[model samples]
Target: MFNSLISYLDSIRERDPAPRSRWEILLYPGVWALFFHRIAHWLFGGRLFFLARLVNHMSRWITAIDIHPGATIGRNFFLDHGFTVIGETAHIGDNVTIYQCVTLGGTNPTNGVAGKRHPTLEDNVIIGSGAQIIGPITVGERARVGANAVVTDDVPEGATMIGLKARSTLVPAETWLREFIPYGTPCDEPCEPNSGDRAESLERQIAELRAEVEALKAERRGDQPHKMSGTNC
Candidate 1:
């Protein structure tokens, strides 16, 4: 446990592997989040509801993140950057990577009743920046949520989700890592051609057809001689 803490600290440090001054690095963002979350989760589970709420509020104040105390997060859960929001009922598995502006929230409109209303992200899942996995959905193990995606339904194991309303682009683990690890390459797979592209292609085809029509009209004009209005011989 100590080693894990140390490693976690190191990851948040400048040199990563090398540890900096204990005093300075102690308040690293990730470490602070982990510590706060650990305490908050513990208090939440122990039936200290008010205290848990307080801790969660404090965490939000300090970290700019709103993680519900009731949310169950497993070990080595890394919230990399930006404002991450986890709903009160979110269930995050071990080794989950949540990036900036990612939200694991519920979509249920009813306020009173509650039972598993939030998303359950399975182990080894990596959610990219600005991804929103909303409602009581099970994002399967090893699933990858692409940047800026809005997912409402359940994602299968090892699936990669992208686009608005979220469509799955299934691929092998090795391929996914190779394409997505470094980031900034659009989506991982060859997504269906965008409407804009299709529209542009159609426009080009229309232009070509119009040019052909004009040429045909010119050829027909050239093929016929204009009748002389009053000429005879």
Candidate 2:
């Protein structure tokens, strides 16, 4: 058990550079939140719903991270910071890293059945700060959801998603091959309101359109002389 705890702390250290030692990592709110979640989840599985809820509330109050007792979390799942929410039916696989203010939310079903609504995150998935991954979608292994992204669909393996209503961008080979990307975003990629390549393409198009407009205006001005001469004739 001590070895497992050490392993988990080491995993966090690999992802985050701020922690000086394992003891500093242990002081993190995310670590405490996960610890409380384990106790809560065990009680919940034993059908002690009230006790589970009680523990969940305590964790939330202390860590400012709310993880439903019914949520299933795998080994070495890391919540990097606080103010994150994990829904009741959410399932997180091993080595999933979630940043601050991220939400693994569920969609309400009209059929009155509280079925599987929350998302399932596969192993090595990274969710950036303020990302909202809603519905029963499955985020595939090594998928990255960028900061402030709204993802309502299933993310393909090794895909990098960004922007509102998040669109998947082509992951560069260097970025894709890296073990851990800070904030689920590639520093090499331009962090813009739109996808990096797409935004550059749009700018090129706008420049070409402006040049064409200028050429058309010049041609119209030159034709004004001919029109005036023809009127005199």
Candidate 3:
């Protein structure tokens, strides 16, 4: 457990670039949240509900992040810029990447006794900043949820979801990282320009080209009659 904590600290230090000092790095709320999560989760599973709730409340007070003790979180689950909210029945799998302001919430209107009200996030899912994944839907493994996306349905494995209603802008894992990953100083290359807007621009150019070609053809046809009359003389 001590070794795991050390490794987790190392990971946080390595991943975060804006850490001003060693003390700042050590004082990250995310690390503390992870520690509290583990303890709360253990108490929850052990049926020590009162203590688990106390730990959960304390963690939330300190981190401004709320993770229900009933929620199942897997290994190496990093919450970047943590202050995110998770639902009681939410099930998160291993290596899940969750950014700030992401919510795994329930859609059930009653808010009664919690029994699978929240969503299930499968392994290796990357949820972008401020994304809202609500209801009892399952986000499949390796799926990518774009920033500020509002997803209310089940996302397929390896699919990339974007926009308000969360449409699939599917891309392979390698292609996604190369083409859509946002710019960063540590990143090797710039993201490919968005194809959707580029396609619209191309279509507008094509329309203009077609109109120009038609005008040229008409001008040639008009001149041909005059040329024919002069030749007939």
Estimated TM-score per prediction? 0.65, 0.75, 0.66
Model 1 — TM-score against the truth? Answer: 0.65
Listed per candidate, the RMSD to the true structure in angstroms reads 12.7, 12.5, 12.6
TM-score for candidate 2: 0.75
- Candidate 2 lDDT tens digits, 64-112: 9999999999999889889999999999999999999998888665455
Q: How many clashes (backbone atoms < 3 Å, residues ≥3 apart in a chain or on different chains) does model 2 have? A: 0
Clashes of each: 0, 0, 0
Maximum-lDDT candidate: 2
Best model per TM-score: 2
Candidate 2 colliding pairs: none
- Weakest lDDT window of 10 consecutive positions for candidate 1: 179-188
Winner on lDDT (2 vs 3): 2
| Per-residue lDDT of model 1, residues 93-136, tens digit only | 98778878888877543435668878899998989999988877
**lDDT of each candidate versus the true structure:** 0.76, 0.89, 0.79
Candidate 3 regions exceeding 4 Å error are 20-24, 109-113, 166-233
Model 1 clash pairs? none
